[model samples]
Target: MRPILSALLLVVAAGAVAQPVAPGQRLDGIAAVVGEQVVLYSEVDALVQQTTQGREAPPDLWSRALDRLVDQRIVIARARQDTTLNVTDDIVSQRVDQQVAQLAAQVGGEPQLVQAYGRSIDEIKVSVREDVRDELLLQQYQGRRMREVKVTPGEVRDWFDRIPESERPEVPELVRVAHIVKIPASDEAGEARVRAFAETLRDSILAEQATIEDLANRYSDDPGNTNRDGTQNGGLYTTLRLTDLEPRFQAAAAAAEPGDISPVFETPFGYHVLRVNSRDGNRISFNHILLQVEVGEDEAEAARETLSVLRDSIQAGTPFEAIARRHSEEPQSAARGGYVSVPQTRQRDLSAEGLGPQWRATIDTLEVGEISEPAPVTLADAEGTQAFHIVLLQKRTPAHPLSVTDDYALLSQYALQEKQNEVLQEWVDDLRETVYVDIRAEQYQPPAGG
Candidate 1:
């Protein structure tokens, strides 16, 4: 979700709910009242503190937050009257769990989180659960209210054209490449050594010689698991995105089942023995012990020699993609003929520049058929470890301003959002009229322009 919308939702949902005063506490005064719900000064104060936490906020942030809260409460009261927008308990519970886990991770862990908030985990869970439910309910109500919003093609084109040339979207150079990979096998003795080590650890766990937490702390290669006492955080399993994890680890993880322990598997970095702790849908939680395969001077020379030979083969008319698929140890990109899709074009598009930087730089330096110099890159494993990669740039594109013909999808989204916002505002206005809202005279000042 967009950050602006998320903040707006948080303000609305939290503002509408009454904060419980401690038994011995005295109330200063009411801030506002919407229908039967009264907003307290303390509530407004809490919102101000939350909004300003870790950063400086605008001078009128409290007033702005209060206004947003009023708009939200009005809409929420009307939503309750509609009776068609009931958010389920299960959905609320899941959202609550996700938020709680995120909050816990952000604060280091549950114990630290409890200390910071002065609330037990269970208490925090209950509060966060209600907050999630309220937020979800408001979102559902807003979505249903704006269901008929539509943006025409003409509108999209108009918006595209209205964007000033200086402000127009720029398309960066992008490359498309593919490759095949082959990971070198560990020597027989090395494989046997790792297998024996895993068996011993398993036996120890079975015999109560050591706990899973102990083994994970001492030997698990995944740092994420180590922090959680060898447990998967939040009971959520990791999703196998090639970008987020090593290709070999992703492949092995994707294939394993809950409670399945994999035999020693070799990848470019080292040999790993993985144990799948749990699986929920496509998410899999796993523990692993990684043994670094010693690459002595001779071994390093040999591997470099092999890569040089592979590079030569590509130059000698063997397709880079074919060679990558056939011999590259980088499983993630090799299987796709070494093509790494432009990050900005992906669905979520979490790229740092929002699809503007990385590809643009590469496009400037690379050509369609030429390969780039071998560059060192780090590939993260399922447990989040740095595995090295010798990345070759095989493709590139030039930067150009966006056009309607070439950027229709992006323009269409902008058009759709514009239409939705207009409809949502009208809906909110209608709800405000229906809901009985009474703001304290001092707190009811309109915006400066208004």
Candidate 2:
């Protein structure tokens, strides 16, 4: 029984059918009463304007919306009967705040948000929170309803057969790739020197001798934390999730409380010390300074020589996966037999963009199952730090029609959703009979019929 849903029940049937009138011209009246909830004509007019943004709508829009509102009220009432489903006001408030923060960022921050939205930050939050709560409740009900639905292969095939042959999907060229990557690290002496510098900065911040930001400006090698003024941030990052952070960073963040400094830690990006500014739920906002170890020409040459030996071994007899596991510096792919994979569910095509000029050229020349000549490439790693790696290409595919052999997962997902939608529709229909739904019959009349 949200205010927005209750208000839209009463539009003049004749005027709406002929064409839309300006908002001021609409008369308010009750369209239906559901249990204790009432629907109003002006609300319908406002909703049509809100939904279509004042564009022309079909004459029966108000009636159709009224029917939908009645159905929604039924589902909502049913959800209320099941006492275990609980969404708190604070959770709704947080969601609304997060949404507003995102909008504020898009419009050049909060001052501009007021300009674009014609409302203050607090005003917008107050208005949207109830609507957000309603959405969350509906989502919870539907999510619980569909949780155990699992579609089978036979069902997927049946779904595909129903589509016309001319309308079945064609797939893009898909490629499977494997690689070996190596990064240069300074000799032990150079690494020790960098680690010592990071330790010194941590001590300095602790003693209040100098700020983490000042130290970052002088020494942090990461390219991602630069300000608009071209000065480096002391790695001040906000709204970060610990799980999304690198293991070393996550551990450091978790071990410290707000206003406490984390012990120095090592990540591929560099050695670092973090100062926690705030913690909210599972997210943290923090400042830190990194001191990256600089590897010299000797280190780079040693890395290249090592990769050359690895390439020669793969050609001679050794399996690529075994050699990559022993030596590949690209941590993620190295563990997975050197394979470069798209998220199996997200994409089927791996476009050739940004693989570096060397990788792009090597991939283009290779046939399926052919290995590329060992090549030098620079990789921008997860922390936005750069390292040089030697690479290999393993497989490529040409464009082809989608089939059970190549696209089972995608087809199964589509069939599953269709089944879920049908189940949800039936659930809604069942709810209609049990609820006290009063659609005002006299309000919607047929034109003089033959």
Candidate 3:
């Protein structure tokens, strides 16, 4: 059987439910009530419309959508009562801001978003905050409960045994690889120049030679300081939580009192000189000037040379993993001996077709146990920074029928999912007994004991 509770359905992009139309403009009414929560007819209709996307609705589609919504309401209602599952106000506000920002970006800007939504950005934020909170609560509860469900080795073997030989699936061509990435190191001279420039800007602000805003508008390298319409923000960030800042930047900003000009500090992006404009409890407003160190041809070539040396070391039988652990610049992968897995998943073997063109092309030419020459590859860094790396193709498995011996991980995943589904169903069944669920819509039946 399928899982009882599906992933929460977010309506109208990031839980920004459509506003009610003017009175008599359209028909709307409550579809059901789960404890104190009311489910709107329009909510169910909107989900059905989104899922169908102009295609013909299958039988019982509306009822199925309502069931999903009811399940969410029941879960959220119960989760809210659990003190351990409490979602904090700060977290909710942060999520609300993030969703609004995303929505504004998708619509071109805050102004465009206001025009489309028929309300101010602040009003829109208020309207969506509760919905975002509910979604987060549902997610938190699901994660907590699902983490308790696990599958054993015997369960995995049994799941594989139940599948007939003729019905077994094919495993795609997968490769396991490790890499030693070297980002171009900044030259001391270039870094010193940036530091000097940052210090000079800070001094100018302190001595009243120039205002920080003016200098930031003129020289700050942070793109966030610029607006979409060619206007500069003067490096002003308002109502920012320390948690939203880069760790190093947060430390520097936290040390300064309101109206203090901080000493020049360095983060991965580069040097910064911060001026705390104001502070209110945990919220702060600040203006800053940033100077990014430029990476020139010499720096790039030096990184390539370093990777070349590491490649030679690995070829000379000085274990690839040992060299990677000591020198790989990407912290997370370096900790795992430079083993790069599929993002967000624990699987080490990756499908060649899913890899980026650069990685796929480079790995295609190398035999198992062969290390490729140092070559330029894009780092997964936020800035898409260019870097050099030497890749070792550790294992390459060609397409074959899935087998218990060769595909245990994949089988284990299937077994775990099945177990989690059954557990979730039991949890939902228990909730139905305790929660008061009333369905008033025609042609829909109230669940037993609900």
Question: Largest TM-score belongs to which candidate?
Answer: 3
Model 2 agreement with the true structure over 40-128: per-residue lDDT tens digits: 55444444544554366776765665666656666666765667878887788888899888766644468756654457889888877
What would the TM-score be for candidate 1 when compared with the true structure?
0.48
Tell me the deviation in Å of residue 307 in model 3: 10
Q: Per-residue error at 302 for model 2, in Å?
A: 3.2
Query: Please, what are the lDDT tens digits per residue for candidate 1 over residues 1-450?
Result: 001122233224344223333223344467779987656664565465555553666777767677776777676566556667778788878877787677666544686556545688788878666556656766787766566677788999888878888887677533444433323333566657765776787677657797555665677554454343544432123433221245456556655666665655665545665667765433356666665543244444555566667777778897777777777676666666666554323322223233334333433455556554443233323332222223355534345578888667667876877777677767777777878888883743322222
Runs of candidate 3 exceeding 4 Å displacement: 1-28, 45-58, 102-116, 177-346, 354-360, 369-394, 443-450
Clashing pairs in 2: 7-43, 8-43, 8-44, 9-40, 10-40, 10-41
TM-score-wise, the better of 2 and 3 is 3
Output the lDDT of residue 159, model 3.
94
lDDT of 3 by residue, 27-106 (tens): 45677899998777656655665566558777677777777777778888888888898789999999889988876665
Per-model TM against the reference: 0.48, 0.46, 0.54
In Å, residue 399's CA in model 3 sits off its true spot by: 2.2
